[model samples]
Target: MNDRPYHHGDLRRAVLTAALDVIAADGPSGLSLRDLARRAGVSHAAPAHHFKDRTGLLTAIAAEGFGLLAATVNEATDLKDAGVRYVRFAREHPAHFQVMFAPGLLRTDDLELTTARALATDALRTAVAEVRPAEQGDDARLAGVAAWSLAHGFATLLQSHNLDGAVGGRDPEEVFRTLSGLLFRQG
Candidate 1:
């Protein structure tokens, strides 16, 4: 019940990082602001300054996750490579991805979340541009959705162990590349 305010300059980031770890280890149901404070080594009420409630904390984590995802996906040299990168990001940052798309858990209206989502979407759009260089407007949008679906589905399947038996003895990355190739029309 320590009532001292946290003077740490980056309390918000600390709380969000802790929350992500907790969610990763125990899922969303195990997250608590007080528990985060304990893990963060801050006073119980310190988290309130950064996140008013559990939802606020979740929103922050989702926002950070999206930003990281965008950065990771955008680093690929080509659109097809970006799809592979997206799957890698999901696998490498399982905790972040878990919170990023867990519906109703994050505050979608929060400014940080909105901006992060937009950045992530822009990364997807860039990948689409690489695929459909000449197509503009609606066609590009459609292509983006299709590409995202392909990558997301593959990542989700891998994450959930849905493809374990199907791809026996094959590296997950190799499986992802093979599956992605089937879904994507290569030029």
Candidate 2:
């Protein structure tokens, strides 16, 4: 056996990127650290250097997903637009979305995961702040929940092919515009 030390430079990122690709193609259930290391062209134990175990790798993936979602949501021009962006991100990053909300798979206490989740939540809170009317207290919170629910439901429906026949011929952006407009109609 070759005696060269298997020091994979930037192994953490390499493993994570490889893991994302694997999750995208085969779902989270199919992920394996040894497989990830192989894909990264590193030794089987290389991934473990960065991620202690499979759970650590999964937590990192969830963290990355939330970070991307936060950035996308924060870039929206308006609160209503941010809701649309949320749905767009989910549709565009189905693998990430699939991993982000998969309970019992990620370590909830992991610092990276917690930080990323906070950033995403903060982005949503900012969006809510923009649209909340004065004198609306609990109602504002409810509105935020409604916005999230609508976006998540729409994304899930799109992913599951439930809307394929229903949304035929209509541009996705146009559909989002109409749906967001209806949801955010001024009362």
Candidate 3:
């Protein structure tokens, strides 16, 4: 049990941290608000006070993940950089990544979730546009979708250890770069 003191919004942070830990270890299906409250060293009802229920908690995680993804990819210098950033975000935040895309587990209409998703989408679109100045409209949109699919598919495979033997000790990010280069041969 945590012996740390709780102040103001500390409980919310604690609960969120605990939830992430649980999700990291056991995936989203294993998350329980009661278990989170116990892990956070607070009353069982404490988490409910902040998140209302399991879906609400997952919604919060999804929103936070999208926001983090947007910020991460927004730092990219090019399309490959953006794809690398997306893969890195998934690798670094597997729990969040797993939860963020599971539409069935989230509050689809949640304002924060919708807003964060938009931010990530816009960032990816901007990255695609910046990379292909002549390719606008549907071409740019398709490029963004293709880039996203490649990065997302690679990240998911990497996370599941499907690339362990195939990568042959190469850094996953580097492997992603190689793969992205093959798929998106610029000029």
Candidate 4:
């Protein structure tokens, strides 16, 4: 047990950081509010004050993850850039990425989570619109889905080390750029 002070001005942030560390190390299933409180050097019940329960904590993580993802991808200049950024976000925030997509573990109706999800979806749609205009209607939606699937699948594979043989020595972003180029022809 760390000897951190019992009082914290930002207990929520402290608890969230501890939760992320736990998730990254042992996966979400191994997480416990008690463990988070210990990691944060607070009382056993301290985490509950902010998170209420495990689901609430997971919801917060999902919301934060979506917000971060939206900001990351929103900076892209094009669809390919957005895809690459998405993959990078997964790599950089593996704990958040893992929780963000697990609908069963989160409060699907959480206002913050829903709003953040919308922001991320909108960011992806904006990127898709740059290539496939909205005038194409369903085609644009389909393209967005395809792009998201490709990026998400690639990120999952990369994190699982399943791409070691296929990617060889190449950087992931460069490989993603090449892969996206081959799959998506700019019109």
Using lDDT, give the best candidate's number.
Answer: 4
Q: Model 1 lDDT vs. the true structure?
A: 0.83
Q: How many clashes does the backbone of model 1 have?
A: 0
Q: Model 3 segments beyond 4 Å from truth?
A: 1-9, 133-135
lDDT tens digits, residue span 82-162, model 3: 999999999999999999999999999999999999999988988888666534677877887898999999999999889
Clashing pairs in 3: none
Clashing pairs in 4: none
Compose the digit string of candidate 1's lDDT tens values, residues 104-164. 9978889999998999999888877877763578877888888899889888998888988
Residue 59, candidate 2: C-alpha displacement in angstroms = 0.6
Total clashes in model 2, counting residue pairs 3 or more apart in sequence or in different chains: 0
The candidate, 1 or 4, that scores higher on lDDT is 4
Please identify model 4 stretches exceeding 4 Å from their true place. 1-6
For candidate 4, write residues 1-187 as lDDT tens digits.
5456579889999989888988988999999998888877788877888889999999999999999999999999989999999999999999999999999999999999999999999999999998899999999999988999999999999988999999999999999999999988766
- For residue 92, give model 4's deviation from the true position in Å: 0.5
* Candidate with best TM-score: 4
Can you rank all candidates by lDDT, best first?
Answer: 4, 3, 2, 1
